[model samples]
Target: MPNLRDHATLHFIVLIWGFTAILGKLITIPAVELVFYRTLIAAILLGFVLVQRRQPFRLSTGAGLKMLGTGMLISAHWILFFASANVSTVSVCLAGMATATLWTSILDPLINWRRIAPFEVFIGLVIIVGLYVVFRFEFDHAVGLVLALVSAMLAALFTVINGRLIKKHNHTVITFYEMAGACLGCILFFPFYVRYFFPKRGLVLVPDAAIDWVYIGILAMVCTVYAYTVAVKLMTKFSPFAINLTVNLEPVYGILLAFLIFGDAEKMTTGFYIGTLIILLAVLAYPYLNKYFEDTKNAWKDRRAEKRAEKQALEKQNTTNQDPALETIKVNR
Candidate 1:
């Protein structure tokens, strides 16, 4: 089990991740360019760490291509994630991203060709109600919320794909390749991005301000590289259940931090908060609900086994009680 310090460290890492949207808003660069630089720097940092640790850097061509494809999804996810923050308040963006669990619940069964868990579907519907409440009250930020929701869907897709890939490859190596792929994707898309999206400004690769560079650096290095590596290490000590349950709090932490930093700008309607609360409750309850179902199934199995044992024992007792005279006759024969 992880000690208190380990738990604290994990929360600190999550806090850094929570700060990511804030950092995205604080930086003056456009979302696409921001993702490009973030991935580029993070890839370089991770690659250096891999080389220093003498980790293998090569993969089969097929796996490399798969990682590259997945990288595109990651790139899209980050772009929309940051764009949401740019267009609306950080709380709104994070609130939408918080629905990622609901997306995963729907996608995982379909993608993996398994029966959908009914409880998961029930919770997912609850999340939808929450979203409706938010949308009804905060129609002005609809675009941002929609963008963030798309980002969450992309996140769920990539996560499911990564889950499959990690079974056969080193997690760190997979992350490095994915980051490299994301960076390459950003580079390839630059022309289209400039021609269509921002015809007036042209291509702006570097941050205009020095302080923006600082924020980007912290985003790439501390948030992506350091936190990712440390979280992987922590997996050896903590259960995945524990880690994921804690990660569900990222939106909560982010929203609170956004309020703290941006003050009145981060405030939202009562309906918005109610919606957020409902979504978070569903997200947080998932693991416990899953565990409960599993435990109940196991207990049912145990009870059946006990009944079978008792039935056999009683049958044997009945047979022995009637068999003494018959046994003597059979022995004599």
Candidate 2:
């Protein structure tokens, strides 16, 4: 179990993650531009932190390329995440994102060579039903919902990839490379996003208001950089499931914060609330199920170890008796 301070820090990081939606809404820039700024700022900040910590800032060629690829996926996820918020209400965006666990269940076995759990599949199907309810009611926001689902899949993919990388490297180093890749992806996509996605549709990248800078700063600094760093650090102490389960609260925190900040604009129909409730319930249920299975696995391992130790003790006693007889034979000879 994590210490109290760790628990506090974990919640704080999740809170920042939850607030990202509000910041996305408050910022005036387009999702592509905003994500571009976010990745650039995060990469810069992580670079400085890596230097300060005196960790090796370089990686092997293959590893470096892999990290960058992972970062690009993350960049895509963030872009879609923010775009979802822009096209739909924050509540709907977050509710859609709550399917990340379901994505993980389907992805982990395929990625990590593990057997799929039937219960996980059943629960995941339940979550899909919840999503179907939301989609049926919010059919007008179909594009945004699809974007959010894609984002969740991307998020799950990189998350599983990161779990393997974190074992061999420091969290900061891993983050720096990923952030660098995200920056590169944003820059590469900038011209295309502007020319094709924006102007072709007659949308603007630059917001008219000066106050947008403050929101961008909060989104980049507090939410992206700080929250991501803290979460990475926490992974050293917590299991991936534990960390993700905690992060699952992002929607709840975001939904409440959206209501508090945006008030009447954030309110939804009774069906929407019911669907959100079902999704959140799944998020809350994951930790308990994970804990139960983990504990069961540990207990089984302990029993096996005890039996092995007992067998070793009996073998040693037999060896000791045989040694005395062998000594007697040597003396008689």
lDDT (Cα atoms) of all candidates against the true structure: 0.93, 0.85
RMSD, every candidate, angstroms = 2.6, 3.1
Predicted candidate 1 versus true structure: per-residue lDDT over 128-166, tens digit per residue: 999999999999999999999999999999999998999
Question: What are the runs in model 1 whose C-alpha is more than 4 Å off?
Answer: 301-333
Tell me the tens digit of each residue's lDDT in model 2 across 1-333: 789999999988998888998888888778877887888888898888878888787889998999999999999999899999899878888888888888988999999999987768877978888887887777887787888889989999998999899778877888889988988998898777768877665445466687887788788789877787777779889987778678889999999999999999888877777877887888678777877787898999999999999999999999998998999999999
- Candidate 1: worst-modelled 10 consecutive residues by lDDT: 109-118
- Candidate 2: the clashing residue pairs are none
List the candidate 2 regions with Cα displacement exceeding 4 Å.
1-6, 200-205, 232-242, 304-333
TM match of model 2 to true structure: 0.88
Q: Which ten residues in a row have the lowest lDDT in candidate 2?
A: 199-208
